[model samples]
Target: MVKVATYFAMTFGAFLFWQSMDRVHVWIALHQDEKKERMEREQEIKRMQAELMAQAKESES
Candidate 1:
């Protein structure tokens, strides 16, 4: 009886650990996606600024 109880406890602990790891993996993936989007947005903003500067220079000339 003691052995069976120990086995059950270990199985439950493993299941909990697996679920926590899955959550961590998902969180990491989401964080990476957000970072990628932020970088893309920054690049777009920089591009627009450069284009505007070029247009202003053309008007001045």
Candidate 2:
């Protein structure tokens, strides 16, 4: 009876560990996606600023 109880406890622990790892993986994936989007937006803003600068230079010429 003790052996059976030990096995059950181990199995339950493994299941809980797996669930926690899955949640961690999901959070990491979401964070990476958000970081990528932020980087893309920054690049776009830089591109727009460069275009405006070029236009200003042309108008001055």
Question: lDDT by residue for model 2 over 1-61, one digit each (tens)?
Answer: 9999999999999999999999999999999999999999999999999999999999999
How would you encode candidate 1's per-residue C-alpha lDDT over 1-61 as one tens digit per residue? 9999999999999999999999999999999999999999999999999999999999999
Cα TM-score per model: 0.96, 0.96
lDDT at 41, model 2: 100
Span of ten consecutive residues with least summed lDDT in model 2: 1-10
**Cα lDDT of model 2 overall?**
1.00
Candidate-wise lDDT, in order: 1.00, 1.00
Instruction: List candidate 2 stretches off by more than 4 Å.
Output: none
- Provide the lDDT at 41 for model 1: 100
